[model samples]
Target: MHAGSWHNRYPGESRIVLDLTSLISLYDTALAPSLVLVCAGLERCDHRVLGISSEDISRLMRKLTEVVSRPDWVGSGIDQKTLIHVIVDRYVDRLELMQHLLNFTSSDSQELLQRAKLAQAQLRVMLTPYLLHSTVVPSSDTSGVDAPHWASLMFKNCATMHTSVMINQILLMTSSEHL
Candidate 1:
């Protein structure tokens, strides 16, 4: 498979899948469908889909679960339920997905894991009111009525806003440091 070609189309998905593959190769087990659900959710937010096959998602999820289920994960304060929440929550944007996945794979620091967990919880809490006040459909058009597309738009907005905030903070810190 030409992973690079797919990468050009899907951006971060290739790396995410590769990372998951390497982790799962060490263990010989079948992958799960829930993992694909998580990846699909993230892909929907990014507005990029390279026609990911069911097999690919299954393998990726298998590796993901294996990596997260390690004994040290619990000690780090990120458990299965937290992972599920992140995966199933359609409101979770690509940045949040990337951040959580990075933490799942490379977070040796408990502080970082805790922070990631907190961020996910905060996002969920923020969505609760919207979910309650609005209908099942998200209101995205001029009509101000709810539609399904609203969720994806909201996810993109959240990711964009988070990225802008981070960039601004970095710039501020850089200027202050120079001073």
Candidate 2:
């Protein structure tokens, strides 16, 4: 009988009820200090919520290269080792995609750019929770245009790689209009 698992014993009692006043109070009590820390970091220009440095990236890549792509690992049994490997592999894939996005370029084809734009928008829905508006605010805001949607996708070590192509397209469109 675990203390937290009391809910498991009485399933109906597990429901959480909250009114607006309680919710606001909870936010003030629990989240306010966290927000202050975020503000302090912003003041110090310390972006990246999880502080993902290049060493982390390199380590992840090296470990992933050593483990996940191995043929023997693919057919391995579903044990603790295999599960950890699978999770690491996924994280590595995300990091690779993030790297690709950080160096993203657009094709000359408008149709392809359009397709990429559509895909980028779709990707944003899933990415919003991971993104921060403050991180996006300092990016290039050309000719009064707001920061491109892709700029907002930087999170920890992963970003919206899908949006880089569209960002190039946006830049081209804005630049060409002045020419």
Top-lDDT candidate index: 1
lDDT of 1 by residue, 26-98 (tens): 1132444334444554644463325545786667776678677765422433333333444445345755755
**Candidate 2 regions with alpha-carbon error over 4 angstroms:** 1-108, 135-179
Q: Give the 10-residue window scoring lowest on summed lDDT in candidate 2.
A: 18-27
Residue pairs with backbone atoms closer than 3 Å in model 2 (clashes) = none
What tens digits encode model 2's per-residue C-alpha lDDT throughout 2-101?
7666654422342453221212221232323344444452643453335434554555566557555555423323233333444455457555554454
For all candidates, the clash counts are 4, 0
Q: lDDT (CA) for every model shown?
A: 0.52, 0.48
Please provide the root mean square deviation of candidate 2 (C-alpha atoms, Å). Answer: 23.2
As for candidate 1, its clashing pairs are 137-147, 138-146, 138-147, 139-146
